[model samples]
Target: MTVRILVVDDSPFMRKSLQKMLEEAPDLKVVATARDGIDALEKLEEHKPDLVTLDIEMPRMDGLTCLRKIMATHPLPVLMVSSLTQEGAQATLDALSLGALDFIPKESSFATMSIMQIQQDLQEKVRRLAASPRFHPRPPAEPPAVRPARPAVPSVPISAVPIPAGTALPASPTAELLVIGSSTGGPKALQDILPALPADLPVPCLIVQHMPSTFTRPFADRLDGLCQVHVKEAEQGEPLKAGTVYIAPGGIHMLYGARGPKGCVELTPEPVSSLHRPSVDVLFQSVADHYRGQVLATILTGMGADGAKGMEQLKRKGAHTLAESEESCVVYGMPRAAVERGCVDLVAPLPDIAGHLRRHFRL
Candidate 1:
């Protein structure tokens, strides 16, 4: 089937370029091109394309604002075209939270990149998104009847297993950091886990969620408001602290490392590895290298084997590992891969993960 696309950008050259590129694919078509968000909205009524490729920077209405409106009114899948700068990264992430499906970097030389290479990437993204199910805007479901909030409970530290002679384990449980890897249904899964955590939880949580840049901060902000713990986008050399969650920003990798007197989170602008920025593998590998038995690795719902290898590293290093079970996942790919590799120490449903975490920490 032909995948219909609406191309939205302020640059006439960009719009034309995208149109030409997409038209060359037998299974894809640029049904419409809009110079900006207003024009895109107008074209939406006329063409009803199956997907949209949006530019982050635009006059009158920016991509994010347009994305929010699109998600609210139309809810078609959108892939953002963003620059590599920090501002662009932030905006791209915001777009993701606003419900854009994914993004491609709009480098200054993107136009001159091998047309064949660009075409291949564009086709893959468009086909994947088009084939994926779309999220429709719906009224909020009524909340379940309120019950008494669970009382705060102190977490008991799990007895640390000794690392191998060559490996390292932190001297205290407080020195350990939790590294979480997730994708697909991660945002909702994180909401379920974080908000239920007590204010005094004893370890910092570092999360690698498969998402574009601007969206992670908003996702973190949403978590911060609802959860007892503080949530923020991870920064370079940021010290991990108890009762806090750090989400890796999109378009960059977040690695675990020793900073000064202790281990902390580090951000790297490394080229995409394993087809993802903020790769689960990079985070897991780093944790294994630095924290060894002090790490707790959990692989959640996602579409690939991105975390499986890293989970194996963590398991070999004697860190406890968990996987979200099949019944609870939007896609069973990542967790399933980890489980099959014998890397998962336990498999639990989404609702049960928090309880297991509480039990593990003895909270």
Candidate 2:
């Protein structure tokens, strides 16, 4: 089935470029184009497209306002077109928080007529968003007024079914470090999971979320304010500490390593051949090398098989591994890949993941 798309951007060149790129794929069709948010709304009502490619910085009604309107009135899959600037990064993060399915970075001035990267990213994201049955706007989240105290986790009876969908068996206490990987619908998923973890978590957490370099810091900051555990973007050479969540910055790989007396995060661009800069395989394999059976690794929602190989390595080393259940995943790709590889120890839905972690870590 051909996926109908509405392209919204103030730049005529960008709109044309996007339309051209998308139409190149036989499955994708640009049904209409809108210059700004107001026009985009009208186009949305008129075209009722399967997906929308929205630009964040537009005159008249901004993309965020338009996205808010879309989610409020008629929630659908919306992919944001964002610039690589810091301001653009902030707005894109806001858009994701507002329920955009994903985003593709745009260059300033739309100078390049033929952008291979943007074209490839646009086509893939649009098609996936259109075809995904799980694609739905995330419910709007009100930013917490203040950093919240750790919410209490109520105890439940241990179930005979050891790996039930919602319940978790007590996890082994030997696991010392926690590493998580996600993509596609990860921002909202992370928001759901991270804040629920107690502030006094016994082990440090490392997260690899596929995102642009400019956006990671802001994303981490947003999570920091909302979560009980201290969350921040990982800095090179910083010691990995318990009760802290380190988010890998975009455009680079983050790995586990020791700095003489303390274990620290090592950011590198080597093996630049990897598909994703902050590749899950890179991080997971590193943990497998250092901690082996002492690690707890998870593959959350994402678009590709990046983490599956790493999960296999971890599993061989006796690490406890979890995959987000399909019913709870936005894309179900990464976790599905890991599960198919026979590496996942638990398959849990999004709401239950943090609880499982709490149980495993004895938080």
Candidate 3:
């Protein structure tokens, strides 16, 4: 079936460029175009496009407000197109929280960039969103009944302080940097893990969760509110410090870089590498290059094999690599690929991954 899409943006040039890129795909059709969110909503009713390419900064109603309205009413898949700046990053995050499926960063120069690059990304994103299950908002279900508690494991110190109860304590020689990569099901999975980390974790963390712009900041804020550790969207040249986690902003790739003695994080808006912004491969390879033996790389639930080669690189560099066991992943593609490539040193269930980290640090 041909996938129908609505192109929504205030910039006439952007709308034209996007429409042109998307229509080039034989199976994809641009059914309509809207200059702003209000117009898009009206067109949404008339055209009922299967997908929407929305811009964050539009007049007469911003993209995020429209996104919330869509989720609350129409519930169709919406993809945000944003700039690669701090404001754009934050707005993208807000849009995700409002239910945008994904996003793309506006190319700085249509003239300089190759059409192939635009076509490839636009096609992939639309294909993925088209394939995605429709959004269904249901009233919250009651929490599952609590089960009997298991006997607690003995506590250990990862640093100067004793680890908190329920937290996985890394054994001596604990990792100085924890690197994580995830895609589908990542936001929810992160909700599970980040809050469980002790507030006094000894190491800083870097994460690459495949998502579009306007999503990561909200994810970070959600984690920050739930976890004791400070969580923030990564900024270029930001120092990797203990008790904090840096999430790679959507619509860009984040990589580890050197800043004097300590490692730092950098975000790039260069063309998509390995089929994704915040690509797992980009982050993992950089971690392997910079931190090498001291890094603990975890491949979480995601689609595709983006992280497999990077995990291999990490393993060869003597870093400890962990893959989420298939039984626990929302989609087992990434970790499974890593395991098959013989790059993963260990496979652990999601709930037990923290425990594994603790044990690996132990002598």
Model 1 residue 37 CA deviation (Å) reads: 3.1
Q: Return the TM-score for candidate 3, rounded to 2 decimals.
A: 0.63
Global Cα RMSD, each model: 11.2, 10.1, 10.6
Best by TM-score: 2
Task: Assess every candidate by TM-score.
Answer: 0.67, 0.89, 0.63
lDDT of 3 by residue, 1-363 (tens): 899999999999888888888888899999999999899999999999988999988889988888888887788778888776667777776676566766777756765777777578778778766665334323468999999999999989564421122333334345778889998656656766777777777788888998656667767877798888899999998888887999999878899887745678888876454578878898888888777437788988777898889989987977777777666665567887888787776677678876665455442
lDDT of each: 0.79, 0.87, 0.78
Clashing pairs in 3: 92-214, 92-215, 93-214, 93-215, 170-358, 171-361, 171-362
Span of 10 residues, lowest total lDDT, candidate 3: 161-170
Clashes of 1: 9
lDDT of 2 by residue, 1-363 (tens): 899999999989889988988899898999999999999999988989999999988999999999999989878889999988999988888898898888888888567445776677778878777765466445668887986789889989874423324345336655778899999999989999999998999788899999989899999999999999999999999998889999999999999985633378999997799999999999998888875337888989888898999999988988888888877777878998898787788898889998888888877
CA deviation > 4 Å runs, candidate 1: 59-61, 108-118, 133-176, 182-199, 209-239, 246-278, 289-294, 300-303, 316-319, 323-336, 339-342, 345-363
Better of 2 and 3 by lDDT: 2
Candidate 2 ranges with C-alpha deviation above 4 Å:
136-170, 260-262
